[model samples]
Target: MDFDYDLFVIGGGSGGVRAARIAAAEGKAKVALAEESRMGGTCVIRGCVPKKLMVFASEYPGLVDEAAAYGWEASAGAFDWPRFRGHLATELDRLEQVYRRNLERAGVTIFDQRATLADPHTVRLADGTARTAKHILIAAGGRPVRPSMPNAHLGMVSDDIFAMPSLPKSILIVGGGYIACEFACILNGLGVEVTQYYRGAQILRGFDDEARGLIAEMMRAQGIDLHLGTNLVEMAPAEGHPERQPTEFDAAMGMPASDSDAAGHAAPAAPRGAPSGPIWVKATNGSERVFDAVLFATGRAPNTPGLGLEDLGVRLGRNGQVVVDAYSQSSVPSIFAVGDVTDRINLTPVAIREGHAFADTIFGGRKTAVDHDLVPSAVFTQPELGTIGLTEEQAREAHRIEVYCTSFRPMRTAFIDRPERVLFKLIVEADTRRVLGCHIVAPGAGELIQMIGVAVKMGATKEDLDRTVAVHPTISEELVTMRTPVRTA
Candidate 1:
C-alpha cells in the first residue's frame, strides 16, 4: 500500500532519531520524525549531558580544598548559577541544533511537534495532521514524575533543575535513587545546604550493597543531611502559614515507604498571599524544616500516555511502557518500540543500541537484536559509581561465586587528609573463574568501568584479569593485582 512515508517515527529521542536517520540514510527509506519537544530527548538535552556537566562543576570546590593541602593556595568562591546556567543553556542549544541538522542531513523530515499513533500505521501530530506510514516506531522516552503529596506542586523534578532561576540556599531532596543522591551531592558541592530524605535504608537500590553503603557514608561525610528510613508527612508553604503542625506518627513509616502512596497525596488549599516561597515539610522522623526548594527524584514514568498506543491495541505494561519483543517489534506487526518507552534497559546507550538494531533488522535486512546483558552504567554523584554485569547478590543466588573486595584511601586523598576511601570489588564464578561483575566507587569510576565492561562482556575469566600486568600506583590496578578471594560460597 502506498503511504506518506516508508517509516514514520514518533518521539525524537535518542532511539527515534537513530531509527529515523538510519532508515532514511542507510536503507534509503522515506522517514519523518515527529518530536513534541527538543530533538536530543532526555539524555542529550536534560538527563546525561547537563547532569554530567553539573557533576564536573560540583567537584571544583573539593578540588580547590585539596589544592590547598597540596601546598597550593586555593579556595572556591560562591558558584555563579547564572553564569554556569547560561553556558549550559548554550551547550544544550548547540546540541539540539546538531540533532536537528543530522536528521535533516540524513534526508529525514523533522516535525517539531508531538505525534501519537492514530493506527498501527498512522501517526497524528498535535497540529491535526495525520500521516500514514508502512511502519511506525515509538521512542517517546520517559519523564520525571512529581510526588502526589500535599503542596507537592511547590516541589520540582529533575527537569526543573536546569531551568531553576537560581540555586536555592537550601534544598530538600526526596528519593533514594541515583537522581536524588546525585543532585544532593551536586547541590551540596555548589554550596547549598542539601538535605536528602530516602525512605529506603540505603540509596542506589539494585546496585552493589557495599558500594552503595560506602557512597552513603561518603555523602554524609560531605555534609549531606541524609535521612534513612524517613518519609514525608505533610508539606505547605513556609511563608504565611500557621505554626508547625504535629505529624500523626512520631516515627512515621518505616524505611522503603511506598512511593506511590506518598506521591499521590493532594495538596491542601493554600492561604491567600501565598506567593512563591520556601516549603515546610514534616517528616516520618518527626522533624519539620523549611527548604528553599524541594526536588523530587522519586521516579520516572514512561511517556506512553495519550500517545494513542493503547487505543490502537498496542500492548502496554503495568507501568505504561510499551511491551515489545526481542527485536523491538510490538504485538502489532506494523509497529515497533524502543528506548525508555519500552522499559527495557532504559539507559541512553541501550536505547541507541536498540534503535540501531531495530533499523538494521527491519530496513537493512541485517536481522539484528540488541544484546541486553552487561550494559555499563554510572551514577555521576560526587564520587561516581560505575558498574557492569551482575551484582554480588544476583551472582550468589545463581552461582558458586568468589568475591574479591578492597577499600582504602587513595594516594590523592592521602595527602588531603580526607577520610574518603575507594572501593574495588569483583564477583567471579567459583567453577569457571569467569568474572561475573565489576563495581567501583571513586572519582572517574564511570570512565574506568567502560574499559572493564569490555573485559566482562568478552567473558574474561579471573585468570585473564590476573594475567594482565598491573598499572602501578593506579587505583584500577587493584582489579588485576587482587589475588585472593575475600569470600567464597
Candidate 2:
C-alpha cells in the first residue's frame, strides 16, 4: 500500500513471500514481492501439492481392493479423467486465491510480474517496470528438466503430467529418481501398465538398499515392470506391425505402431482412474516399446533462468542454484537467498525455516544458520521411506556407528491378508551409543521417523530408546525393542 518498498522480493515463492512479509512486519521495511506464476512456489503450486493429489488418486484403487477383503463387494472402478482433472484445478484455484489473500493481509505489496535482478539493489519486472529496494531476495525455485532426445517435445515432465493432453494407458517412464518412482507408483496404482527404466543398478539410489529391493518386489507383484541399469538408445515408429523396435525413450511401451500393423489393437484399455493411451517409451537399454504417451521424471533445476542472476555476479552452484553463505547470504551482503534456489536442503519446511532464520538473524538480532545434518525428510512412494541424520553407511564411516537392522511382517499383514512386511534399521555409534541413523519402510514411516529424528537431534542413545516405555502392539514399538545388533562396529 505505498511507494518504493524497502525490500523487493524477486520471486513470490514460499521463501520470498515469507521473507518479504516478515521483513516488513518486524523490519519495518516496506516490502513488495513479484510472482510470475501462481504463488506458493514449487511445493504449493506444482511440486508437492499436486504430486500428493496424484498419490491419493492412485491409492483409491488399492482401497477398493481392500474394501472387498473386508466383506464388501467392490468391482473394478471407473475413472473419469476430465472430472478428476477439473476438480484438482478447482481446488488449486481456491488455493491460489488463499495465497494472495494471506500476502495482502500481511501488508506486503504483491506484484504479478516476472522479475529479474538488475543489480543487488534493483529489480526489473516482466513489463519493463522497475522497483528498488535496500535489500533484494531471490527465491525463484526450479524447473523440470528433460533429456535431449528425438521426441522430448511430445513427452511430459512431472510438471506436465497433472495437466496431460490425455491419460496414458501404458507408460514407459525413464529415470530412477523419486520423481520417476512417484509417478510410476501413481500411474501403476491407478491401473496403467507401467515400466520404469533406471540407468543405475537400483532405483531410489540414495535410500537403504533393502527398502529399494522390497519396493521393487512389491511393484513387480503389483504389475509394474522394472528395468534397472538401462538407458535409451533410439526411438522410431513401428513400421507395418507393432512388436518391439527402436523409438524415443518417451514412447517406449505398448504394441509399437507397426507391431500392431496398421491396426490400432483396439487401443489397450486401462483400469479405473487411469489414462487411456499407451505411453511410448525408449530406454537406454536398446529396447523400444510403443506407448500412447511418455513421461520423463528426469528431475528439477532451479527456475532462475529468466531471472538474471549471472549478470549480477551472484555466484551459482554447479547446478545453477544460487550459492549462499552460512547465514543464507548470497555474494551480495544486502541481498540474501533461501529455499530451493540455495539447493542445500530442498524441502518445503526447510525453506520456511531458512526464511524465518534469516529474518531473525538480520532483523531480530539473533544468530542463525541452517544445519544440513539432522534434516529429516520422507519420500512418499509406495512403502514410504523416511530417514534422518546419517544413513548406516554414512554413520559407519563418520562415527564408527554399528547398524542394528531388522525385517519382519507387520501384524496387519498377518491378519489383513496383505503380504507386504516392514523393515526398520538403526545406527548407533559404538563409542557414544548415540543413535545416528534410522531407516523405515512401511505405512506411517513418514510419521514414525519424525520422532526418531527428534531423538537423534537431541543426541539420544540406544539405551534411552530401549528404556523409554513403548506403546505395545505398534510397529514403532519394534524400533525400541531390538535386542541384538544386526552388525557391530
CA RMSD (A), model 2 = 6.0
Q: Report how far off residue 485 is in candidate 1 (Å).
A: 0.9
lDDT of each: 0.87, 0.75
> Residue by residue across 1-489, what tens digits does model 1's lDDT show?
899999999888899999998999999999999988898999988789999899889999999999898999888888888799899999999999999999999999989898888888888889998999999999999988877665666677888788765677777999999999999999999988899998988899999999999999999999999999998878766654465332211112111112234566554422211212366889999999876667889999999999988888889999999999999998898999999999989899999999899899989999999999899999888789999999998899999999999999999988678899999999999999899999999999999999999999999999999999999889999999999999998
Model 2 lDDT, full chain set: 0.75
**Alpha-carbon runs more than 4 Å astray in model 1:** 241-276
Deviation (Å) of 177 in candidate 2: 1.3
- TM-score per prediction, in order, is 0.93, 0.89
Residue 337, model 2: lDDT of: 86
Best by lDDT: 1
